[model samples]
Target: MSRRSEEKLAERADLMVEEEALRDLAAGGSGLVGLDGPGAGTAAKSAKAKSGGGRGGKEKDPARPRQPYVPARGWPGAGGGRVGYMDPPTMWRATTVQACGMWPFAAGSGSPMTGVPLGQHLFTGATVCGDPLNWFTRARYISNPSLFMLGMPGLGKSTLVNRMLIGLAATGVVPLVLGDLKPDYADTVRALGGQVISIGRGRGGINVLDPGAMGEAAARIGGDAGEVLKAEAHGRVLNMVAALITIVRGRPMDDHEQSVLSAVLHHLRERTPPGRAVLLPDVLRVLTEGPDRVRAVTLDRGSDTRYRDAVDPLHRSLLGILDGPLGDTFASETSTRIDANAPAVCIDISGIGEADTQLTAAAMLAAWSDGLGAVAASHALADAGLAPRRWFFTVLDELWRPLRAASGIVDRIDALTRLNRSLGLGDAKITHTLKDAEALGTDADRAKARGFVERAGMVVCAGLPKTEMEDLGKVVGLSRREIDLVSSWSSPPGWGVRGEDDEPPGRGRFLIKVGGRPGIPIKVAITDAERELHNTNTRWTTNEAAVERAAARIAREVARPAQEGPPPALAGGPAALALPGDPGFPAVEASAGGWTA
Candidate 1:
């Protein structure tokens, strides 16, 4: 456009703003143009007189200002009232700009004040940039550093992730899975070209990290605990390790350096002992590999440093993990050709409980962290622009369990959130119990979890119990009436998907958020084996040991019913669903002593 055209547009915009301001003054005392008293009107007139114009020679009615804007503070709602915002002569559309650029602010549209476009959001896998919630439309969100996924059994946390992989597989972005419980699903992941090693399973498998491991790993190089590491102070060490990793990037601690750390830990143990300690395999790996293994680096002077140069090389490795075999291994798969496709990876955690959850989660987190570090160091982790298209997702169905495990897990997780994103690695954590999240991890881990939820680029809640409804309502800035919308995942199709959108239709409905919007309601699909996501549901009856146990249980309980009751329509306890069906509908026949077949 010509300069004259641009100037005309600017003038029009200014006129509109001035008109609105004067209108606001006439309408209410609280508007930006509001009058404090009758004297306020005289003051304005006097100012205009001093300027030699009542209305800038434009329109000479008794009201309205000649200038479009005038900066001043101390006004209500201008960063002074109960809920004040920045004090400035902001454009009317300023909210639109600020809303889009800021992270974790109360959800709102973009502001002209900040001039950031409130564009849709997408997920950034280790090597790709795209939307994580692809199956359900209208919930586009830019991949923020945080993501929260909640659901009950069979709620598609895994399945949807697979769809996400399919959507962005070409981007070469990949993720490191932190905690996928069902090792049986390894094949599916391998098909995606991801290199996954299960930790906490056995000796050959990655061992579940433990506090003892922390102490052992530390002492291996004959390092001192600038403070000693005690199990009782697990949480502190976990936080320290996490804080240190973010600083050190997995650099190794020299012998004397170890001693200093031990001393620092020992000092903290005496002065402020933690409730528990969680041992992270990643931390152990750093100490074992001697620090050249991990990525982030911070000198220990302020926190202490210069022990060994570990973080820089670790950062280099991260680029490889995100771009190489590990990237594919951590993703979902469609065929035996591991590199050909990337699939969403999710694990079913219906049967696992807290303390027992550590091992499984460690496995998944380990894989994910490795992949994310690689992605961040190279191409995928840039703060601006789209993630390089290659993307992979790891969905943790019951994440809180592992986080709550000994204190060591907390910092490791924070490290995941703090450092892992951007390289095409997205950690999708689904939980039934925020309380589990609240109670289990060290205070630091719990804080990290909460921080994640608060700043999530996208958040969806469905079918929550009432207490959860109340708790989340406050967290997301929802009203009491909105709280009633939450329900369980087991509910029908769209029952409780509530968030920044209109009441979504169907049972088990969910509200979807994208960059400060509550735009639409969406459905969280259930798992049917035929769907894209590989369901890691195991049949106890199908297992050799489980089959033997069920067979034995059949001998003791569940007697053959008399002629009175109808033939059982469904599968039985001792005879799990995996058993062959009596499809012929043959008449009842006895077996063994009860009756000969």
Candidate 2:
């Protein structure tokens, strides 16, 4: 035997020993590969017999075969049938402070649960609540309690604001829609049992000289607070007069002109009887009379001619507000005073034509002055403990009109935005787009207007053109995804089918951006009760007869057989379907079984 022959014989003996060990294990012996002791094999077999394969323990049948492995077809793709090697990802919720330690790299803890519950988070499917005032005073998430909302027309800008108004009203926050251009909030205000003060030609009116709720508040809150309220009320009237002059003259009043006007207003207020509101006509009368106080401010030097010349321009403008295109809207006593204690108040200026930009601007300025004065008075009374503490939600819709109407209006709104927090006011500024600010006359006005967005606690944006995203990004720090999402919402509507109205792609979608954090995209969902109140397009919408026809057409379509094909064309061309209102389409009527043409 050579060396190679001895090696082959040794390998054969080792393989035989391994095969015997495997056989013993299959017969229920210990699984240790090389262990072949009689005691080990007997112990393993006894354990296997005790632990039977059946539900109840029973002796194992040696003749029974093991169950065969069956393959499963799961989701399509490689490894689809394989069992998961690891558990699926899970979500654990915690407060922001706890989340910092748990997920240091996490983007956010989703939208805050505080504030007004607007709608669901577009991405996370979580309920998103937001309100600038609530966030500022309650959650303390933002420094300022003001919001800026911008979007395109017909995209539910007014609807979203109405939602916040309704929510805040429920939370005991009064909603004051200072200037409702399209009367968008009138119905909602009425439904909320609020005051809807209309101001337009042949409609209602607003007396610019009236102190509104401030007078009552001042009397109720006597002492230093009362004096402060009176002073603030006086200042508001002065500012409103100045703003109106600026609008009419297409230029702001000079220092001397403002002084003369202020002096005239003061004289008029002094002579007015208690509980009697001042009117614009009274101010004009005082200026005409050349009172000593007015003359001193104008530096007439005791010359009647000098006094008249000094106030000639101011007189003409005030006269224009009374008798010009503005008509009796501002000259007469206010038709309906704003009820500060009401759930909401909407100054509907939509009765004014859209072409009358200047008049609209003046009306807006006056409404804002009156509304804010009421807010200030409310705060003063609450502080004095003479009235219940109340929070006001101010809606400044069609913001561009006022900014463009008068440059002075910008300064007024700027001051309001700054002092909103201290005054217990949550301001919401709504406009078509950011470009509206850029369209202002002067660079200073444009910059100040843009600050409205910058200083806001949060910016809620709706369907806007791609062109708007560039300018909006500068103020809101929008990410590419957010920009794309917002721009996508501006897509045009698709063709209507089955007698349904064609809705805009981004009708109720909004992106709420706060600071540099990721945006919260929300789709506003209105309740059934709000459906009729939220319709801002009543002018362009179909009449009742057309609506009934549409309803019948829809009923016919629903009852029609699914297998029914398109109607035949007039000629031997491709079959064409007749639209609901098409002339050739047949009228639908109800039958015993269903609707029929």
Candidate 3:
């Protein structure tokens, strides 16, 4: 072509070729410039399907009609809908103990299996058990074989005590519930063929001057140690009596008065025969009479007057104990003996009330002293290898009330705690809180009381108030986490709720702090019969049938005048009275259902 005409012709020719290629691509010919690759036709089909169009050739397929895109709506801003991936801010650092504490599944090693099986651990399914005496003698996991339990009422504190005592009893370890507020131990005592000494008006009494405890004290400490322990035992009894005076007098004992009381107890101990139980009346006799040789001993008449002054207050104090509400319970000889080998020897002090603090304190002290003696006797047997190394568990139930009631109560408790070690005894102090210990008289008294908490080899705590939990931590060396754990235990998830939600700490649930081990949550369980026997929820329910029967019998007797004629000779034996489902009468269980139409 000529210059300009040739170029125009060339451009027209190029346009024609491009137009042909576009027409072919529109017809899915796959012959376009970039569409000529090996997988070019497959890619074309994918694009055609995505655009809602029909494909071409063997791979041809009908594309589904596309729906218009609609965005989800919510609170405005980019925060709506599925969120975008965001980077983590930072990694937190924590120690293993701290880390594990945050997570319940993570727990430290369990307590050594040195004692009786108590219960299953709350976190792990491992078995948790503890016996202070066992831990003490082994010298492995614990320092002392004393236990302190803190929990609210109805949290199974006393019930757990009963279980421990009975469990030990089965192992040939004698058990003694020294002071019982709920008094549930009585039935257990009776069931185990043990005696239950109930101290109340017209009930069995304890001879405070009984030599059994002293004798055991002497045996537990042989030779010079025994002499020292014997003297301690003597002093304990004297102090115990003095505390009783202080409780009754509503104040602490004067120095001179205390001396006079001690001298009187000493004289009574010397004069009383070993075979006879030294009664409170005997001590009372000494206090009032002031000894026959007292006049000769005094160098001056003023000395006699001073002696009189000391003796008068003590004598008056003695009179209150011997003639007050406790008179019937303590003035006479003990009706029951301390059988060291018995399964249990419970002193039912439930009859003694808060108003009768003096009586309760005196009764508890007496029972505790007597229990120590029994434990001592058992130890002697165990030492000779005559017995299977028997030990005793001495339980101090509702320890706080009596602790607050008397001035010398802490001293008596301290003595018991000390003497128990040598006497083959494990002391368990059952109370609500550590504050009870701190509530003693002076700072020194409070410190002494606190010693009980510290000396305890194991601490079993249940749900406690936040304040009480903190107080417990401070007094007994509980960690911050432990205090939080205990306080949280105050109420479990959905506690006291109905249905499956009712996850309250029903019974025997406690946080056990043993030696240096981490806190272990435990749930103590027993058989149905054991539950019935150990049910100490006095305020909730009781032996309704027995109570009703008693009331009915009393009513009948009151209504029907007695014209005394052999007093209606028994038609049937004692069995007839208690027999369930008799011919004419329904059983207690049936009667418990209430009057039937």
Report, for every candidate in turn, its global Cα lDDT versus the true structure. Answer: 0.43, 0.81, 0.69
Query: What order do candidates take by lDDT, descending?
Result: 2, 3, 1
lDDT, candidate 2, at 203 = 87
Which one is best on lDDT? 2
Please provide, for model 2 over 476-557, each residue's C-alpha lDDT reduced to its tens digit, 9 standing for 90 to 100.
8998889999999999888777777888899889999889988899887787788888887788876999899999999998
Of the pair 1 and 3, which is ahead by lDDT?
A: 3
Error of 3 at 551 (Å): 14
Regions more than 4 Å wrong, model 2: 1-109, 494-502, 545-597
In model 3, which runs have C-alpha deviations exceeding 4 angstroms? 1-111, 213-237, 251-274, 277-292, 296-310, 377-389, 475-481, 492-507, 542-597
Q: Which pairs clash inside model 2?
A: none
Mark the 10 consecutive residues where model 1 has the least summed lDDT: 111-120
Residue 215 lDDT in candidate 2: 81
lDDT of 3 by residue, 442-476 (tens): 88888888788777888889889889987777656
Scored against the true structure, residue 266 in model 3 reaches a CA lDDT of 67
TM-score winner between candidates 1 and 2: 2
Most accurate candidate by TM-score: 2
* Residue 61 lDDT in candidate 2: 47
